[model samples]
Target: MTADDQRTAADLLDAVGPAFGKLRRTALLEVDNPISAKDLSRTLVLNLVLEHSSHSEVTVGMIAELLGSDPSVASRMVSDTIKAGYLTRAASQQDGRRTILQLSDSGRDLMTRFRKHQRDAYDYITADWSEHDRLELARLLVRYVDSVAALKERSRTKEGDQ
Candidate 1:
């Protein structure tokens, strides 16, 4: 890329950082319970389990990988959530020696409410947007994120090679 292209790309990516921060703040404000970043992280892990995982069980290692966090940090977050009655740890059905996490009833309830708040926020923000525009935005945003993730993986592989 040319220097001008690089600068423009950096500027655009920098703008997204603050936009994401604002979104995070808005989400925290919408939640009824006071929560720390760790709590939010745990909630996100639970959401991933609920939405993405086919087995409905996740290990701390999986959480760490998903969150791009250290195992210790992920473990702490998991422990906190478990203590708060948001998650339960049990032996994996496939392997009794392996442990997995699942959301508790309270966690499910919290996620349901959180999802509604998120949907409401999106509806409000896009009230004037045509349905086609909304769908296109969602599709493009996911594509952008996936592209960034792929780029990051490539960078990591290059670094490892070096």
Candidate 2:
């Protein structure tokens, strides 16, 4: 990126920082119980599970891997979700000892509502942008995420080697 582009990017980041902070605060305010002050992270995890996993069984390990979290953390989240009436666990048909998880009806309903809110929020934020701008933003965001993932993998490899 040119110096002008870098400056513009920095300005954009600076402008959006407060917007995200406010959004995070607003989301927490919406929740009845602020469990561990991790509302945003939990919501993201729930979204991942709902989006990637079919109504079919999904393993705790898969969720953990996808979220780049420890298995115990994912297990705890699953347990909490189950307790909250959002998820159900059953014995895996493939492995009797292994548990498989699926979202309860309540979970699906909750996700649908959250997704609608998310879309509306996103749309409002980008309302002024043209379709081409929206598509370019989407493409760039994907590339940025991919690059960050690669950097994370490299860091993990370095840590493992040491």
Candidate 3:
């Protein structure tokens, strides 16, 4: 809460920004299957679909809303994913006018590897932490993430009211 504490936190973030970039590069490089950064965006779209959708089916509109992307952008990414054999789309049974997307086997395989890389990254980041400290950090991180999400929601609501 003090000015010194605020400055130290800001300084830490500035110092860690490049470290975060390096870690992301390292993790992406560690993936078993090679995927270009450009291609990874579509893969991320498919991953979100798997994470949030039920029956393994997601609509373009749903993806757009979840990602805060335009419907056209989500549609294009879906098409790209399908072409890459990471996802497939079918006519929605509930609503014939809408399309539903499902992740293909390759997509699932990629996600598995991605998860492993993420675990490794987290492990590396916490290598020096004691068990108790690790647990406390995890708890704090969860709370921080939740608070940020709530703040984002409040900001959106405030914007809407203006």
Lowest-scoring 10 consecutive residues by lDDT in candidate 3? 26-35
How many clashes show up per model? 0, 0, 0
Per-residue lDDT of candidate 2, residues 79-146 (tens digit): 77778777788798888998877778987776776656656655666779888988797788679778
lDDT score for candidate 2 against the true structure:
0.71
lDDT winner, 1 or 3: 1
lDDT for each candidate structure: 0.77, 0.71, 0.75
User: Candidate 1 lDDT, tens digit per residue, 107-160?
Assistant: 988787666766676767777988998889789888988998799779989999
lDDT, residue 73, candidate 2:
95
Better of 1 and 2 by lDDT: 1
Candidate 3 structure quality by residue, lDDT tens digits, 105-146: 988886776677656656666779788977797798779768
Which portions of model 2 show Cα errors greater than 4 Å? 1-40, 55-57, 142-162
Which ranges of candidate 1 are over 4 A from the true structure?
1-14, 27-39, 55-57, 128-132, 145-162
